[model samples]
Target: MDIIQDLEKRGLIQQTTDEEGLKNHLRNNQVTLYCGFDPTADSLHIGHLVPLIMLKRFQKAGHKPIALVGGGTGMIGDPSGRSTERSLNTTEVVKGYSEALRRQFNKILEVEENENSVVVRNNYEWLGQMTVIDFLRDAGKHFGINYMLAKESVSARIENGISFTEFSYMILQSLDFMKLYEEEDCTLQIGGSDQWGNITAGMELIRRSRENQDEDIKVYGLTVPLITKADGTKFGKTAGGAIWLDPEKTTPYEFYQFWINTDDRDVIKFIKYFTFLDENEIAELEEEVEKRPENRTAQKRLAEEMTKMVHDEQALEQAQKISRALFSGSLKQLSGSDIGQGFKDVPTYETAKEEIGLVDLLVNAKISSSKRQAREDIKNGAIYINGEREQEINYTIGADDRIEDRFTIIRRGKKKYFLIDFQ
Candidate 1:
């Protein structure tokens, strides 16, 4: 299969250096490539998926993928695609974050004990050893002030105050490219469109480093397009913050729902960018989306594929079960974890198991404003506890009411849900 052609068709390739040469390189042999991911957060988010999936794409195409963790460069945050300066993380914190990111990527990009397996690398090995003097003498000298200002990353940050540390990020990334080129023979670098400046800067370093020796050596850079929602807002953002890959930060159910709720306008594009399905499968989904938009078959498939890849079959089943139970108002079969994910966003209150009298609990838990309202709600049969209608004002919550003796699901009126923790 022509992977580059498929990527182009999916609208993934935004910018490239020597497209014809890159296509030739991938077609002819197993090309070694790398994409640098800065460890700015403890967990990888949906925004990080584009380049990560790009690495997986190349790996699937029988190319070598080196996921470069920015353990060293992460100390000095990259100013690309940021409106303000990032708070500097301590060396210890960066180390922790880098390890976490490596773990997450290791799961996504399968690294088998084979010749054509994905590899993980950290820039700290070399960058941590280099002195400020060596860095300035080696990489800083090659970068001209005019040339740096010409790059979009630096220019955009010039208006806003950008620190010297962040300003030197391009040099660090360039050094990464050079280091990988020397050690792993990685000739290509890929990233999001925002990384174009740093990417080309890396190519320039490679070219300058080999100026006298084998100047004909070809190093390329490719970038995926910036993802945007069909509504013209930013992707990976919601009422909650970013959709994190870590199940703790963002539950598997939430992650699956993010994709399952994709707008029809964006599903086909996402199916292409995110899924590994062949053309025929995607074509079939496209037809389903066109024919029956309400069925949400495309969205469900996208959710299933992504959830299974990120989490596992067990986690996917849990997410699916939570979704189904919530939709049908059938909460009896759900497990504690499932209920936790479903009611994570709902209002929560804590009370002793014995103290949870339905009427008093509603008022005290703020589900109802007053005792009168609580009584009226119960009399009107508008209260449901654990998916069962409750009209008795004297109803008392017990161990039986708790899902796994931890949580009690309380439905106020029809749609608003509340969660009560029974200690």
Candidate 2:
């Protein structure tokens, strides 16, 4: 069995109407598949990663992929898998988000201009062109009001009241799929388990559109499991919100830390979901989990591989450098960028332009409980500047302490760190 079959064996296929037929189709020729991304955020969260990973897997197995950015349907938010009507975003915001997300998508898949590579498209191209009359005459005729309401996505939100705009969302999505099928010859649609309703709507539209022609335009829908932690809390979300693919939204170090700190129970499953490690490599990591759990070999590798895949080699290297520096109690070699990325979690304080004593600033930043303690630490050589011990109690922290004219990393005692952002 190949990788797709292997994925199926591992229960990665949460729902597919015709799995055997799809497999047979793959056996014959390169299947053109698509997964749509709504421009809900500037960067995709971990929730979006599942289908992207599936698309990546399909691409690896010799298939073409269409990454559809929902520029049109985003205006009319999909009610499927939601309890409430989504707050609408402006067209300008959605357009900007779509472009940013496309760049991130390019990083994960083979999106180059080749036959088997990926192609990015926006539904707005067609949907925007269609007037209300055209939409109602051409696309709206195919969908029934009763059929739309019966969908769990719509029905679940009806009691609370759903807007007509959101109710029509599925029709637009179906149109997107049908348009791709007609123009791009895209044969399969993949999404999370929550998207079954939209996927089936597209499949049904294909059937109805060809009923008069006596032709069967078969399309398949595949969904991967919605990722959840064993603790029953959401995955890829922290108190800070979603761990984004874009480094600017969530820094490389923070992103690395998110995966590195995954619960021990979820590490193996995460490896399957997030990384491209082969079965044997995963098994070996599982063994390491048993023999030397404290080393956290699996989690670190998972973080490294994913961070490198999403960001770049430089971000991954910086994350690792900061991790090592923080862990080994040696941060002397860290640069200004390293300090900003590494110590982001630590508290920060801004000192006035006038010279201020280090001990007083430490107290002001709450690195020490009191000025007395701050003075004691400074006198005892427990304070550090750019990771070097500073013993002088009267040492004035000034322009000289600035790193690359951006930051000053202050160390209190041994492990605690605070960053002074030099404005």
Candidate 3:
């Protein structure tokens, strides 16, 4: 199937300027397409995956994909989806975020030395150098006040308030399209649903700039649907916070868990939106989801593919090991690193690495309320040390109880877990 058909099959295409024309444009030529990612944060989150993956889909179809990091426009901030004004980042901060995004795109997208390999660009390279007079005369002349105001991005914020800086963001983004079209022969721009106005505005600028020259401009825009959960809640978020792509921000294990715990109602849609699995494979997974929801086969596959794609095979294996160890309550098989990743959010206490009575340790770690309660928990066989029932009230926790001689796993009842860090 063609790229368009594949995207359609996956339910990825939300809005396209000219569906037929774009299908033909992609079919006939080695099209150069671009997607812009603003550096609003140091790391791109799971929400950014759809566009990033879309870029890969284009590249795989023998097209050049430009991953544009918004260094210039990021300073002004796009007002497309926000109800309030964005606090502008300093030059140094935007530049740092831009570089960070570039590095992340390099890892996520397939960057190579080949002709159709992904190319990374920063709008700051051009927008940063263009003088205000030149920008107003060349680009700003095409967009009338009414035209700018009519766009949903600006219109939605007019009631609440919109600043001139953000109001002019679309023009700056249009400059990016025009610049890329003139210099790189880029003919397509893709983004999330929120960017439709900006993308089309760029196309308009490209056409208007070449109107007097009598050149046929074929720029187009495409947007992926906004991901929504079956439940009323938002996607890519949990009680903790946003699910970041960076391992340091969200560990590989945590990332894996996020997908593994995909709601039954949203799992199938998520697999289609995120994974590159073929229709047949996806259909089979759908069957698995229907036949054996208890197995969570679909969720596991989604987590594996996502983990390996964002991280690596080794990271995926580690995440799986941690998951299994946690599920089975088999802490003995887990290494220190595995324990660290698996129990990262669990409560922890630190103390000297000396032998101590289990009851005293439980009280000190706050795992038990008092000596009496600690004794009761131990006597009732509700306390477990390193996944083993420790019914001995006088049991001493020492080197034998510590994992890697640095940490101990303490379990109260069935699920409450605590980490004891040895100094």
Q: Could you list the CA RMSD of all candidates, in the order they appear?
A: 1.3, 2.1, 0.9
Model 3 whole-model lDDT (C-alpha atoms): 0.94
Q: lDDT winner among the candidates?
A: 3
Ranking by TM-score: 3, 1, 2
lDDT of 1 by residue, 61-168 (tens): 889999999999999899998889989889999999999999998999877988779899999999999998999998899999899988999999899888888889
How many clashes show up per model? 0, 0, 0
Give the Cα error of residue 259 in candidate 3, in Å: 0.5
TM-score of each: 0.97, 0.93, 0.99
lDDT at position 118, candidate 1: 89
Off by over 4 Å in 1: none
CA lDDT scores, all candidates in order: 0.91, 0.85, 0.94
True-structure RMSD for candidate 2: 2.1
Q: What's model 3's lDDT at 261? A: 93
- Which predicted model would earn the best TM-score? 3
Per-residue lDDT tens digits for candidate 3, residues 301-352, read: 9999999989999999999998888788888889988887888889999999
Scored against the true structure, residue 213 in model 2 reaches a CA lDDT of 97
